[model samples]
Target chain A: MIGVNSSPPLPIDYLYNFAKELFIHSGYVYFPLLFDPDVEKELKASGLCSRQHVEIENSSSNILLRDRESWFVKGMSLESFVSSYEKLAPESYNQHLEALYKELPFLSSIDDNPITDKLCTIILEILPYFVSKNRRHERKKLTRDEVLELVSEKLNIPPVLPEHARRILNIEKLRVALNSLSKARPTCSKLPSGIVSKTEFEHWFSESLKAEIIKNERRKIKRSIASREKFARINEKVLAVLFFAAEKGSLEIEGFGFFATEHEGEFIIYKRTGEYALKDYYGRIYMFPDCRVAIRTNGTLDPFVIENYKHPFLQKHAPGQKICMRNTLLPSTFTAQNAIFAIQEGISALLYGYKYRKRNGYHSLDSIPMPGSTVTFDDYMVPKDHPRILRGEVLVTNEFR
Target chain B: MNLLDKIKKAREKGKASIGVNSLNTVIAIIEAYSLDSNFLRFLDASPYLIVERKNTGSRFTRKPDLRIPIFPLTSRRNYLLAKQVIEAIGNPYIRFSRAPEEVYLSKFLYRENPSISHDELRNYHFEILLRREIDKKKSKNRFQ
Candidate 1:
């Protein structure tokens, strides 16, 4: 029940694809003939061939296969298949084949046999050529001497001489030199006199030398500070210059007040004045607790209004005048931790608000600060009779002014 | 020089002697010395033929039942000189056991003259004495 067909029924390309898929899916790419009994039975049932015979030829691409009827199937080995197909279809069926080849132990059993050893040597020789910069640039083959030179360069040492001159160096002489160099090197400097005794003179000498070097550095520092009085006069002028510079620099004006920068001669006053044309500063602005304010008036001021102030206020006028305008300056509830937390939240809100406004054309939260703006004392106002300006039962004059 | 000339020189230097109990060993010593007349002269002069009883029994008896008389050299200088002559001929007598008498007899013979004869005497009197001693010991044991 055998069919004698002179030619294969299927096209070589189609048969190759089928066999390649079969080999890959079953992990039999290397040992194509090594089919399990069940798989062999399945293959026999398929009627492609009665038997399978695979042969791996000398480290070449070609594989010679013999069927049950003594028919032949010539193709490439697994390595050749990977190399040839890696480029054609890098992400297709061939990609899977290459991956399986790398993952599976295809040549795991190959040892130092003549054939395998020769193949390895040849591969090692040609590997550099494959990785070289220029593909078409033909360079001379590396001689044994050149290879040795490359090894020396890799080891970060001088290249050995060629041929007979490259014998092993005298180990005894090298060991002696190394020992002498180690002994000649300095030792730890901090040990006490009695720690390194006469029996250990070399150790003591090296340690003492190191200690002397450190002591000399310390002495140099002590000598530099011997004439401190001469530098005191220079230090005073430096302090004055720094004070003036800081005064002219940008000031963080805070508290319940209205700030204005004024140039009085050469000095700038970051003025905080509290005088408004409004009747109720409480509803208009809020003041932090424990702030002091100064109130001044030339006319009668209501006692009930001054007594209702949340903050202490000091009132002052021209000899006998009524309390009217008051200015307060005090640290806000912005502790370092609170300030950092506020800054983080403010920044996050600003970024989120900016992005939200950019996308939707409006801010989602009304309380969030606008980008490039900071919370300041100008955002709040002081009330009348505020403790900032008013004492327990009387108004005090502005001491800072 | 040839072997005979060397032996003659060894004998003249007073180096020749043989073990008193071992006939085969004595014969071998004589034959070796005959190759050199100087060695023969030393052998003839030696007073005592130092014998090792244990090693000599094999060459003397078939059933390994034998005893032998051992002679000692008498003079120290002669013994030392004779030893030097024997060493020159590349043959030396090493004593495994201590025997002051044997050492003295050997020294005396070496100082006398290098022509003493002991091969026939060794084969006869020394062997008979050993046999008679062995017989006397066996008879005494049987009677007891």
Candidate 2:
């Protein structure tokens, strides 16, 4: 449900690449990249600052930057980009900007000849540390005309003649087939429009415009979807096997495994419970409490701890506290298969990813005065079929949620 | 000043009339801005504009973009205010450079307590929004 997916994180790799390239090209010492309202909190928290509508790329998120700068970079890893920026001397920052004073590379005009399928068939790719990041409800606003414009551009045909709307798509002679309504076209206004993203935007595209494009265009979209399918598929299959055992009070994957599945609104949520071992970066492990993983089928929304468990990494504040899915990137359209893998990652991250010394997250689980240890999950001996879970068959919706 | 503060001080300051219903809309507008980026923090809610649909009378009333509850801030006032707000927000990583009436919500701060009459701003020509803040340190560096 847009209800659950709500406000997802922005494109980290895209922004990082955009930021690094901007830093290299802009002669100005500082510049803000205005984003859509959706990404405002996320970008601001990352220390990237700046300042919409379907009436093209309108949204609170789209208005993030109030400047002129390029945002497309072919390839650059986030870590390498950030590390390099960190290594740059203060003098180098200015000198670097000055180098572009005469020939601004970042400001070079772009060839907007439909940046669709042309870019890459190769690849695709947020943090939890920033608490209170703007995670608002999805403001999906899209129109038929805009979708038609994009389709027209991609198909490379003269503008559709008003006299022959159906004939154009029905021509059947065109090599590049675009997604079109079979018969009765839905009214544009009733059809929502909002994502200025190829992402959340893409999900919108896939769902709203489910027509098959040429292999070239679909390759890029398909590659992203396929990779995620691969990542989450393995997790789902593996967990199902392990969970089969866990249901009988035996083997549990990682610390715990899935036991039951239930329906919640539009989502099919799989539940995982057990004593999870969270090992900080220091190698010492802490048993986390109330470890309940309730992964909903909706791809965009991360897993939630059904027990209302709030940890540094798992805090979405949705129906149940949603997991942040830190570093775990999902394409705009999260498929059903991705949930289990995401659950696996959520539980695994809690297992060995924590850094005891730094307490690396937006909030700390430890109480004030440095309890010196994380919250304990000592009930490893608890049966996977403990009555607390089995008896509470139905999910009690969190009212404060 | 925030919207509430401005509405309170409107009569004392002899400011333009901000209708009662407009306050709700204006508050909604400011909330939109705050949910956005650092715009609200740098901006005060002084640009609360009341858009009443007037009859196309003796004069040709150009349709203001305000037909919808919200639209892009591409007017000159929008540009100037965005520049001022960006500077005031003092973000070390970003600097904004927008055009005149070309784009998003870089709202207007109609804090002109007395000068511009309501009639003067009662058309498409005027770009009124609801947010304003000035960081002296950053603005000084920018304007200097």
Candidate 3:
């Protein structure tokens, strides 16, 4: 009787875990795979581990001597490892995997096998079939060379033999393919037990072409979101708030408290009970009331004018007015550097982004109205001698600097 | 001229990111993607990444997740290079996600494995992985 949970440890399973830890520590996944001489031969023969001589882009390009150590390089990818491990790794390698598997201790146990059959090893698992949907049942058994050609075309993975065509009359895969085309699962046309339609060889080859495409797309989006998530952790958030505060030098995220979590978009939530003075280039100063700012991880300020005031650029003319960033540009990918620029830019816009004379955006800072628009709220205007002017730049004397 | 040296220099110059002084952390990322074999896995694996428990990552709450920040403790000026390096690494897990970002002693590796101290694994297991990845990054066919 078979044990319920006793499947043999697959090489893929062992390598998967190792690759994860590697990716976490480093952004990349890799391995050192130069323990045996036959590895190169088996890899070349089996069409797994498909990395080639990459001439290191050093200033001195003529260093061919050192360049010769290409195969002995440190890292092998999961795909390359997966491709190679099926042949090079021991079946028991999975059992040997630990939170710590070393080179000599575990990796060295992999005894290499000389290449016997090239295409059969990684075909179904590593290399998905490139068969088109309409061509599922076009005819009888395809020759071995035909199958190899199909696999090669799928990923431009060069054939192992590198020949015109390998002409085996009866490869086991094609035999199965033939059996799929003709016989019903319960032995033949005269089958007894199983349903005929449930078993089709088409699922093996035809369906995977579609599956691989979808998998690739999902992989792209998932990977972007996943790695991107790493940039905005608690460690980074604390640093960002501190850096922004240091750079601004006056404002503090810790005015009340800082709340950074996924729900609130990793924010530096702060409330200040005093007024801030905002000035434009044309010597126009506006006194703003007590402000509360929520700096998001994306480097955007929310409810920017939390004390409720109105200007043309404000989304609304009431409390919790969000500033419009229609005139600014920010980075696409999220990182701390990008965050700095975003926060700085956001602040800069609030501080000196308006032209009182031109009345460029929603409303001019001065009393000048747009061609057909009216100016509201002369109440917040402050004279030059106001005591609570936190931020505003005005030209005082030409020779002061 | 050396990759590690380059990374170190970048890190030093990039001290503006604050508290990201760990060379190994940055090296792990760059080294993993430097190999073509590993780089290609990004294309193959969907969500090939580590979830840092439930609520730890920089913007785990929302990454659909564009509105966030990470000060680059290293590779500061070359933010785009950092991006490319990240893209190149791709997720290698393929059909799998949700693996532990940092792997510790697996139960299968040793019988009564809890008997051994974390120090032993730190000295032997992890060090070996890091060294191998480093060696690979320093290889002739590096980043192929």
Candidate 4:
């Protein structure tokens, strides 16, 4: 299951087909733009490289870089790049650091590198990127007061010197003692109050402190696992139609369809007259919601959607605009709640009428921006004596599941 | 190493400290397996010893049913089957190399519930096999 959903070959043809499907769903015109001859030639030549090289070239990092650079060149600035670096690059900073060390081994040791000034200057230039990139799920920075409180809670010994309790508390010493004790070494007999450590005392303190951190981490992991389980469980019932497809192994050959909807887009227009010129534009196009429900069960987790679109006015802009298909697999957990709900809300703001305009404290109830409208059905239970079940027998359901 | 090797090493290191009173537990396990054709096949393929808990209940009241000898399986197929059987029997303290922890086995069973399908079982087996393969490849790479 680990390797099954790993990186797979991204066929351009399949992507195009998916784009076409999106076009159809979104009421957008399908304009097959001609690729730049030079870029096309380069791509064709690059195709002769070994498969591994191709894989590295097409990796998410390269794709993200290309997209970011394109956005930046098109009037976006380095500020935007710096601000969005973490969002753009979700991979850990350690991985990036490892790659950096591998590339410039001298950077591994901070004390010995001769080019430290130049390195520092270079890093300063890219400091914002690294700063944003390293910001994983943020935790509240503990103050001195909080740290003392946490340590006291872990130690839990009655106050001996009531007046000087705070002054006498040595956090560093306690931390060192705790760390050593954690590794099953009981050599810390040199306490300020020269007392031999007792097993009961050690066990009580160690279990309490260790449990605090371990419990928090375990809770986080369990929540994620539970969320994933819930999503899968709900999908099993809601998307019962696709269950047959997976069961029959049809997903190996053909992908199933899930979503279809439409939304509006803004376009600029310039009008020229004898005295003056003015410009304004607005247009409506079909749009598909991002809740892809057709899970490929043939040892792959690739998402697929088919689209087709036709419109008269779109032909003029076909020469320059290139359609792109980018996917971001958001953090998902198997819980009873649907993982796609958060993603849907994020996409909703982007697709709804240029900017989300609240009409009398409510936005437009367009089908495209809302999930579960088209793809997901309400949870239903099969009734006994229904058409699927024979009429003559009593429904002897098992009391225990 | 195979289960036999693990048992031998554990005994030599004085870690196989279980005494005679827990012979009932060993007998219970063997009896439980004797009813299954697949487990019987594994038993026939390889030599096995059910390490008993000795002197467990007030030293004088306990005695082991029998003392079994240590012998390695002759064939690779038999050895592998015997290994699977022992792993499936679910003893965390077995000390076999690359053996899954009790938590992993519980998680597997929990996830594959209602009932486990053939594919589920195959995938579980394949996961362990793949892990061993990856470890071997890693060690080889490290050596290189």
TM-score of chain A of each: 0.15, 0.27, 0.32, 0.16
- The models' CA-based lDDT, in order, is 0.30, 0.34, 0.36, 0.27
* TM-score of each prediction: 0.13, 0.23, 0.26, 0.14
**In candidate 3 chain A, what residue range of length 10 has the lowest lDDT sum?**
A113-122
lDDT of 2 by residue, B4-87 (tens): 998888767886553323222232333334323344352543322222222223233342332212322222223334444444
Task: Evaluate model 2: give its lDDT.
Answer: 0.34
lDDT of 3 by residue, A1-401 (tens): 00112466554344333221221112112222322224435656755345455443333222111122322123333233333432444333333232112422322232221111111112221112222222458765554345434534442443342221122211333333333323221221222211112133223212332233233323433443343343234232222323332223223222332334454223443334344455544575666554553344444433255556565566456776666667576664444344345544554455455555455567765666556666554677677775544333332221111
Those runs of model 2 whose alpha carbons end farther than 4 Å from true positions after fitting are: A1-265, A271-273, A279-285, A310-319, A362-401, B1-144
| lDDT (Cα, 0-100) at A194 in candidate 4 | 12
Give lDDT: candidate 3, residue A165. Answer: 19
What is candidate 2's DockQ? Answer: 0.03
Cα TM-score of candidate 3: 0.26
lDDT of 4 by residue, A249-273 (tens): 2211111111211211111110111
Worst 10 residues of 2 chain B by lDDT: B93-102
lDDT by residue for model 2 (A116-214), tens:
110111001011111111122325433333332333343343452333222221223222212321222222221132113223322432332222212
Give lDDT tens digits, candidate 1, residues B1-144: 999999899888995564443222222233223323344354443332333443455445322112322432112222334344344432112121112222223333333323334452233333233344446657989999
| Candidate 1 lDDT score at position A305 | 21
Docking quality tier of model 4: incorrect
Of models 2 and 3, which has the larger lDDT? 3
Best by DockQ: 2
Q: lDDT tens digits, residues B24-66, model 3? A: 2223343343432333344333221222232244432221101
Q: TM-score rank, highest first?
A: 3, 2, 4, 1
Clash count for candidate 2 is 40
